[model samples]
Target: MIQRRQGGFTLIEVLIALLVLAIGLLGMASLSMTSLQSNQGAYLRGQASMLAYDYVERMRGNSAQALLATSPYVISLTSGSTRNNPDCRTKTVGCSASELANQDIFDWWGNLQAAIPGSGVTVTKANTNEYQVVISWTESDAQQHSTGSQTQNFTLRVNL
Candidate 1:
C-alpha cells in the first residue's frame, strides 16, 4: 500500500515562524518610539529659536533704549518671574521709547515663561549697534538622554 505525505508545516516550523514575526514587530515598535522622541526634541528647539528671534525684533523696534547702557533691553530673566504690566498698550496715546522697551520686555518674558520649560533669556550689547540675544531652556527627554545635557541655548546677534 502507498502512503500519502501531509502537505502541512510541522509544529516546530510554525513556532519558528511566529518567533520571527514577533522579533520583527518588536524592532518596528522600538524604531517608532525613537522617531517620536526625536521629533519632540526638534519641536522644542524650533520654539526656542523663534523666541530668540522675537526678542531681537523687540529690541530693534526700540533702538533708542536698546542702545542705552542701562536700558531695559539689556535684561535677563531665568527664574520665571511675573512681570508687571507696562501699561503702554493704548493706541490713542503714544508711549516713550523707554516705556515701549519696558512693555516689550514684559510681554516677551511672559511669553518665554509660558512657552518654554525652565526658560531664561539675556540680552547684552556687543557694540554701538550690535547686541546679542541669548535664550536657554530645558531640553526634552530625548535630548537629555542623547546629549547628556539637560538644557539648551540659542543665541542671536542683532544690529540696530
Candidate 2:
C-alpha cells in the first residue's frame, strides 16, 4: 500500500508564523511612534532656537538698552503671563530703546507661544555685552511611564 504525503505548512505552523508576523508589525509600529515623537521634539527645539535668535537680533538692534548695566531686555516670563503688545510701529519718531525692547519681547513671546504652547522665557544678563536666553516648554509626546508631560528647554547665549 502506498501512502500520500502532504508537503504544506500545518495549522499550528501557520498560526505560529502569523503570531511572529504580528509581533514584528507591532515592533515596527512602536518604532514609528518613537520616531514621530523624536521628530516633534526636534521641531520644537528648532522653533525655540529661532525664537531665541530672533530675540538676540532684537537686542542687537537696540544695543543701547541691551548693553546697559541693568538691561531692559532682561526679563523672566511665565507661561501664563499676559503680554502687552505696544504699538511701537505707529511711532513716527520711533520708540525708545526700552520701548523697542518691550515690543520685541512681546512679539517674541507671542511667537513662542504660537509655535510651542505652554512656553516660558527668561533673558539674563551674562556679562556687560552678553546675554543668556532660555526657552522652556512642556512636551506632550513624552514617555508614557512618566508622571506627566516632560519639560524641555533650549538656551542661547549671545554677545553683542
Candidate 3:
C-alpha cells in the first residue's frame, strides 16, 4: 500500500491561522480607534480656530472700541466665565461702540462655552492696530493613559 500526504490544513495549522487573523482584526480595531481620536482632536482644533477668528472679526468690526484707551474687547476670561448680554440687542436704535463691544464679548463667550466647555480666552492689544487672541481648552488624549488631559491652545494675531 502507498502512503498519501494530506491535502488539507492540520488542526494546529488552522488554529495558528485563526490566531493570526484575530491579531490582525484587533490591530485594525485599535487603528480605527486611534483614527477616531485623532479626528476628534482635529475637530476640536478646528472649532478653536473658528472661534478665534470669529472673535477677531468681532473686534475688527468694532475697531473703534477695540483700539480705545480702555478697550472692552481687551479681556482675559477664565474657564466657565459668564457675561450678561447687554441691552444693545433689544434696543431698536442699536448701541454705542462700547456697548457693542460688550455684546460681542458676551456673545462670543456664550458661543465658545457652548462649543467647548471649560475653555478660556484672552485678547490683548499688541500694538496700535494689532491684537493677540488666545483660546485654550483641555482635551483628554487617548495616548495619555494615566497622567490625564492635555491642554490645547489656539493663538492668532490680528491687525485691525
Candidate 4:
C-alpha cells in the first residue's frame, strides 16, 4: 500500500496567518479610535452652536428689556485651555448679560471650561433696528486659540 500525504496547513503557516490578522486588527482599531475622536469633536461643536442659538433666542425675546436695562447681560465664557474669570469678581466690570449670554450658554453645552464673548460687530444690513449679539470662544492651541475663536451672532430687533 502507498502512503498518502495529508493536505493541511503547517504550524508555521498558521502562525504567520494569525500574525497578519493581528496586525490588520491593530490598524483597524487605531482607525476606529481616530474616527470616534473626530465624531466627538463634531458633536461638541454642534452642541456649542445650539448653545449659541439659545442665547440668540433669549436676546431676541428680551430685546426691549435688555435695551432698557441699566447694565448689559453678561453671558459666560472660556478660552479653550486657558484659565478664565468665571464671575469677574476680581474686577468691578463684567460682561453684560446680553453681551455674553451666548458665551454663558456655550459653557452649559459641554465639558469646556468657559465660553467667552468677543466684542465684535453690530447689527449690519442683516437686520434693521436690531442689536447684534456676538459671542466667541477659543478652542485650539493657546497661542492660536485667541485668533481661532468660534463665533456666532444674532440680532435683537427692537422698535426704538
Best-fitting candidate, scored by TM-score: 2
Better of 1 and 3 by lDDT: 3
Could you tell which candidate, 3 or 4, scores higher by TM-score?
3
lDDT of 1 by residue, 1-160 (tens): 9999888998999999999999999989878877897786777778878888888888878877888877778877776567777688675687888888888988888888877767888888877878888888765455334645466788888788
lDDT of 3: 0.88
- The Cα local distance difference test for each model comes to 0.80, 0.87, 0.88, 0.46
Q: Rank the candidates by TM-score, best first.
A: 2, 3, 1, 4
Clashing pairs in 1: none
* 34-124: candidate 4 lDDT, tens digit per residue: 6765564565556555554555565555565445443233333334433233553344686555435434443443332333332222222
Tell me each candidate's TM-score. 0.80, 0.89, 0.87, 0.47
**Candidate 2 residues 1-160, lDDT tens each?**
9999988998999999999999999989888877888899999999999989989998898899889998889999988887787879987988877888889888888888899888899999978997899999988554673446788999998789
Candidate 2 stretches with Cα past 4 Å from truth are 140-148
**lDDT score, residue 76, model 3?**
95
**Candidate 1 stretches greater than 4 Å from native:** 2-4, 90-93, 141-149
Q: Candidate 3, residues 27-81: lDDT per residue as tens digits? A: 9997887788778889888999999999989988998888887788889998967
**C-alpha positional error of residue 25 in candidate 2 after TM-score superposition, expressed in Å:** 0.6
Candidate with the greatest lDDT versus the true structure:
3
Any runs in candidate 3 off by more than 4 Å, and if so which? 2-7, 143-147
Q: Poorest 10 consecutive residues of model 3 by lDDT? A: 139-148
Between prediction 2 and prediction 3, the one with superior TM-score is 2
Clashes per candidate, residues 3 or more apart or on different chains: 0, 0, 0, 16
